[model samples]
Target: MKNYTVVAKDSFTVLGIGTELRSDYTDYAGITKEKADFWESIKQDGRLETLKAVATNNYIFAVNEAVNNKMMHYAGVMTEASVPEASRLIQFPKGEYLVVKGEAQTAEELSNKLTGIAFGQVLSEVKDVAYVGGPNATVEMGQQNGILFGEMWIPVVRK
Candidate 1:
């Protein structure tokens, strides 16, 4: 069984470069590819590195949100600093959050695994809290013993 917890968090902001995903929300493969491509583009062009230079920590955040009724994804960092290349500043409110933690062989795998477990298993099985659909993120905290580890943070309201 997947392990998860509900935790309280203070407000935070992430500076990011984003793309509006064109794939249907239910098309997991398509959305994954789009997010992968977006990450590759940001890395290849040094946007990710630029963000990292000003980051408060080494953690990388992959954020998913809906804006103007369109599915949007972002590669971001927790930073108070702003860059001209950033497409948006994502705001996560102060509230309870559904936090799912896990590890994988790679950052990509970690993201997919955490996302799947959080959305497919944890959220569906858990009671008392419900995700209300704000900007949720898979935070790539770091690696240990050659394994990538992180947590998925989804804002939720107590039901």
Candidate 2:
């Protein structure tokens, strides 16, 4: 059995990353890797008072808390305005997600794990809601490798 610990998440600010069809599932590695690299450089370059990291796949971005200020394109997941297309509407359902934590000291490590897991297991959690289609996402805060780690949230629909 896949082991998952149930826990309540603290409400945290996030960057809701969106991508067009061309950007979805395609060139995910190239695009996300660059973003993660850029974010990581922010600290070393002294652009960020605290370090920030962002990892991306074609459909999602795993971003650090320091990137919170750069978060935009929020489909307002916290608000009711983000309902799916009217004709495409279904019961607004939420799921029991298997949120996972990982640590990658550098941009490459973080990017690889995120992109791999994103298209691998997390997509398995949500059944029919645009795994390949463009969707905004949530990424939160955590710690690992004695460094700040980010938590990626994949909103799944309950069975």
Tell me the TM-score of each prediction against the true structure.
0.97, 0.45
Q: Which pairs of residues collide in model 2? A: none
Q: Report the number of backbone clashes for model 2.
A: 0
Candidate 1 per-residue lDDT over residues 7-120, each given as its tens digit: 999999999899999999999999999888888898899999999999999999999999999999988999989999999999999999999999999878899999999999
lDDT of each: 0.93, 0.38
lDDT of 1: 0.93
**Taking the tens digit of each residue's C-alpha lDDT, what string does model 2 give over 74-156?**
21112222222111111222443335555566534654565466557656654444222223233334445565454445443
Question: Which structure among the candidates has the greatest lDDT?
Answer: 1
lDDT of 1 at 29: 100
Off by over 4 Å in 2: 1-11, 15-25, 50-61, 64-97, 125-150
Error of 2 at 61 (Å): 9.2
Candidate 2: residue 100 lDDT (0-100): 53
